[model samples]
Target: MASWLARHGIQPTVVERASALRLGGNGVDVRGDAVTVVERMGLLPRVRELATDVRGMQFVDATGRAVARIHTQDPASPEIMRGDLVALLRAATDVDVLLGDSIRALEQDDDGVHVTFEHSPARRFDPVVGADGMHSNVRRIAFGPEERFITFKDHYFAFADTDAALGEDRWVTMFNTPGKMAGIYRSGNHAQAKAYFMFRSAPLDYDHRDVAEHKRLVSEAFAGEAGWRTRQLLDSALTDPGFYFDALGQVRMNSWSDGRVVLLGDAAWCASPASGAGAELALVGAYRLAGELAAANGDHRVVFPRYDAAHRPLVNDKQQIGPNVRLKVPKTDGGRCVRDVVARLPLMKAMSAVERRAQARNARPLPDFTRAA
Candidate 1:
């Protein structure tokens, strides 16, 4: 967002609450039109070089037995670690960034937005955007509390750095019990492995920033659940400071902008990580938002509406998980067994072919920003 805005004659100041750009994150996927956004920025080669070379996914039994497999040959969508992608984006943009600081308050008028920072001096700008993640502070201050928009999917998920010995190289090995799923993602490019855990339950009550409490919650949720190296993964991740845990949810808002303040990425429309479209939505949303703002001479009233119209269709489509949810978290032993059987059947291939065709038909070509540029 900073880069695109700057390229189009807008001075952007990026405020990050983190002391620095965090380099620790799980693999993030660049699918569909997000590839165009990267290529247009001349970072496609860099992204591909750092891409996690995951062969595909494999469903396994508790006894380390592979029951079914999916080998993807699709190059249009590649997975790269979230931190590496963020690094690439940071390198692409030349903007003034204030670290360890965030917006304390925002007062937007017809002319501009008056802002106060947590650790920086007060200032005003023509627009202020809350591109923060799902539980965005900006969203809370500007739009209201998070519970109004965050619809929990009745599941909590966690991913953290773990021992690579837990999984075989090049394949994401997953195991499922009723109401829960656990997996290890083995990226050949990176020596360290990532542990993924998800369990279906009522909404959890815990502070979002409390890592220790989050670990305890995860361990408790998976307690007594045996097999598939669950004990070891939990043990390792509980001590690892990089543990990530949160409820699986999506942010649905009728509007992306309020006066001169607006939202972007997961803050505005989080389809959840399960959709594998978070990065795509953020990339395309940022590109379109900046383009609209630039085209309108920074007049957000016109820019926000145009941006919404151009982007919502893609988001609405990507938000649909459909059968993917069943494939991820089977609610019963019978469901898991049936999925295994379906994977071995010819119907799996037919579904894959149909999905590929739909993808081709719904290809969202990036608007020719050359004219807008």
Candidate 2:
């Protein structure tokens, strides 16, 4: 967003709560319109160079034998580690970024918005955009309480760094027991592997920022499982200082803007990680929002609704995750067995191919924002 706006003669100030760019996360897919977005930014070559090159997902038995494997390689959709993509985006964007500080208050008038920061002095800007993630501080301050927007998806998940040697090369090895799954994501191109865990549960009460509590919940969920590297992965993940934990949830909003304050990325409409569309949505949505603003000469009223209209359909489509979560963490042993049997059949591959073809046929061409600029 900052990059696009700067190209159109609009200077954007980015305020971040983190001390620096967060460069650690699970792999994210860059496909469809997001590919066009990266190409426009002149970062496509570098992005392709850093692709994860993972082949597929493999379901493993408790005895560490592969029960079923699903090939997921797609030439059009390159999967890259989240940290690599973040680094590339940071290097591509040229703007003033105020790290370690965040918005404290916002007051809008006809002229502009008066802003107060956590550690910086009060200043005013023409408009404020919230690109913060699902638990957006900007959303809470401007839109209201989070419960009004966030819908819990009956699950919790965690991921952290783990020993690469523990997992197979270029495969996501998963072991499921009832409503829980423990897995290792070993990217063929990266030295570090990530331990992934997900379990079905009612929403738990806890502070989102409390790392210790997150670790405790994850530990308790997988403590009984002592097979197929689960115990080892759990220990390694819990020991990692940068462990990530959160509820699998989505954000739904009637509108993406409230006066001069607007939301984007996960702050506006998050389809959750299960959808495998976070990076794609963020890239395409940011490009569209920035393009709309440029076309309207930074007029929030003119651009906000247009941006919302242009981007909502894609967001709505991605939010329908269908069988993604269930496919990963089956609710019962019988379901797991059925999933394995179905996965082993050629029908799964055929269905996936059909879905991809239909998507390609229906996909609208991405707009050329440079022409507008």
lDDT of 1 by residue, 188-300 (tens): 89998999999989977899999999999998989997887888878877778889999889999999889888899999999987888898889989998998888888888
Kindly report the root-mean-square deviation of model 2 from the true structure over all alpha carbons: 1.1
Each candidate's lDDT (Cα)? 0.87, 0.92
Candidate 1 deviant stretches above 4 angstroms:
356-365, 370-373
Lowest-lDDT window of 10 residues in candidate 2?
356-365
Best by TM-score: 2
Which ten residues in a row are the worst by lDDT in model 1?
363-372
Model 2 misplaced regions, further than 4 Å: 357-364
Clashing pairs in 2: none
